[model samples]
Target: MALLLTFGSYSALDGGSRPLEGNALDGAVHEAGFDHARVGEAWWVLLPVVRNRSGADVEVLDVRVLDLPAGLRAERYAAFDAEETGAPFLMVRDGGPEFPSGRYADRSGRPVRLEPGEVSRVYPAVKVRVTGEVLGEPSACRFTYARGADRFTQVLPCGFTLRLAA
Candidate 1:
């Protein structure tokens, strides 16, 4: 039992983030295209999957976008199990089947827990409603999680630049 406890503690302490292969979007700036005429239209800006490589479980506390540009507002954020639902950008829509049902209740004051070797996709969607041309530097998607009693934050450079299309 002592050995088992030590192993569990070691696994929990070894927790961190890993980039998904073929979808390594870190440091890549994606352009969020929005209609200039159509203001107040919301769109989902999805981030790449975050994988937990530890041997123990980790609880994701919060997810947010850092350094958002003017006119681009983050209305809400969510995390979904990548294995069950696939890509959130493709599966999630305003009136789609997965919009209101398939998402994990991470934002409902409950942290999403990920088992060892699990991958989850984070979405911090932006609401576009600007009169002038909106262009800004790349922003980052940050994820805060806890392993056992220790807290850690992983900042993924899933940058985004706003572009208004005619």
Candidate 2:
């Protein structure tokens, strides 16, 4: 199957700043955007990739999964990859591979700095475990970053609707 262009809504949290873009967004990284098969039956690896369209370097400080569906639980956010550097390191939704240095670790503080026109190959392994029947749900994600010492938080619409194959 091919990837699907899915739309989702987002909101600010923890006093996060609003995004420069619109509320509705598509998962440009993964195929079909969100997941594949059921959660329990499979673990969907979310390789969240985004480019810095801005004319400045975006220092992504932290990323957090704001809300999730009932039956689906966020398991682990592990490892990241950068196209500039072919390597893997321990990473999470909040913690990603360190830029300029290309060092990967299991911590939630280091920021993923993306330069203008630069792409972040963030392979954040999200274990989507399905337990029960679930309806279409929205998964909000907050990305906090800095631009020349100016810190701003933008929320993205990473929601998805899960259903079994007929």
Candidate 3:
């Protein structure tokens, strides 16, 4: 089956001036750009950016990968940008020997506030690499974000097919 994208919304924070929950959006994942370059014998590079123009704070708690030629599944846990660190709460697996599973705080992470007639960037990442056999195989990336107690998921089909170097 073709990958699917779901959007939703949430209410404002309990003790803050911003909204904590997000509502389902009404569109698909807007593709910015993507590239896969063979860096090593079996290593591939990937970079993708997705955005949510939803009127509220969108929370992505988990991500599910599907619809690829091969059977590969990946789940990610994420939280809203921390009030102190200003980073999107994220949980990732498959870290190499150097760094295993741990929390990541983005240096550019910032609280996004929208006005009555304004738009802001929801999610932003320009460089990300996926290793193993998935580097060059046709695959799909489905992501989820979360708020106080609410969550939203969005799936984006890759523009270019993934493959290994010949």
Q: What's each prediction's TM-score?
A: 0.59, 0.56, 0.38
Residue ranges of candidate 3 with Cα displaced over 4 Å: 1-7, 10-47, 71-139, 164-166
lDDT of 1: 0.46
Local accuracy by lDDT, each model: 0.46, 0.46, 0.35
- In model 2, pairs of residues that clash are 3-32, 4-32, 39-130, 40-130, 63-94, 79-91
- Top model number, TM-score: 1
> RMSD (Cα, Å) of candidate 3?
9.9
lDDT score for candidate 2 against the true structure: 0.46
Residues forming the 10-long window of minimal summed lDDT in candidate 1? 1-10
The digit string of per-residue lDDT tens for model 1 on 113-134 reads: 6566655443333333343455
Model 3 lDDT, full chain set = 0.35
* Model 2 ranges with Cα > 4 A deviation: 1-42, 82-109, 164-166
**Superior by TM-score: candidate 2 or candidate 3:** 2
**lDDT ranking, high to low:** 2, 1, 3
Model 1 CA lDDT for position 22: 21
